[model samples]
Target: MFGLPRNRILKKKKDFQAVYSRGKSYANRFLVLYVFRSNGFQGKVGFAAGKKLGNAVKRNRVKRLLRESYRMNQGAIKEGVSLLFVGRKAAVDAGCQDLEKAFLALAKKAGIMAGDVEFSIEKRKNCR
Candidate 1:
């Protein structure tokens, strides 16, 4: 949708571990983001929500929100990179717009994403 194209999502255990171990991390109100450059043609994005966030349902809901946000905002991402978004407990109760803002904010801060992206969520609240 929009100008964002279909890109592969990161799913391998090794990849996740590498991102956690090697990438630089940035924290926001809703999520902890880790970014790494990869050898692929497109960027790979992953989401992780621990049990501390809540039960499976709650965790999955946070992941789903992140996934949707990432999908819509993928056009800002560069190719051949790996990004991992580890959900914070606060994300379990966050709205999609809020979470999207937090994710993009973190990405921008990390310098992996360039230019200003006017997302659907306009009002920037206390989203770190």
Candidate 2:
């Protein structure tokens, strides 16, 4: 299962709205990230893939990829913040590694990730 727990997820519409309206945002080719400092000690996250992305399957896949990327890099993220990731239409065709890199880049730019940690994706060469 995805490592994100219930307490770590931003579930309500109001929470999402707050992040969207008041939080600082950053984007890359595949994703848009909204980050808000919160009163709580732990970070909370939400993933959104709009209808324009495609059918339910496509949207879910995009969301799953975003969640997985966040889950993988959760440790380096700063506490007391809520993060919301919105997937771009191009994300539907992207691989997980691409999404992960984009997510980490945006998070780092937003100053959410710790400074000492390095987040990088390994390149895979196609074998003929």
Q: Where does candidate 2 have its weakest 10-residue lDDT segment? A: 119-128
Off by over 4 Å in 1: 2-7, 40-42, 120-128
lDDT string, candidate 2, 1-128, tens digits: 23678787888898889888988989988999998897852478889999999999999999988888888788888878888999998899998888988988888788888777975566534200
TM-score to native of every candidate shown: 0.84, 0.89
Give the CA lDDT, 0 to 100, for residue 99 in model 2. 91
lDDT value for model 2: 0.84
Candidate 1: global Cα-lDDT?
Answer: 0.79
1-128 per-residue lDDT for model 1 (tens digits): 44333446667798789888888899977999998876751477778999999999999899888887887777887666788889998898888888888988888788877566565665534232
Error of 2 at 22 (Å): 0.6
Model 2 residue 28 distance off true place after TM-score fit, in angstroms = 1.0
lDDT of 1 at 63: 87
Top of the candidates by lDDT = 2
The 0-to-1 C-alpha lDDT of every candidate, in the order given, reads 0.79, 0.84
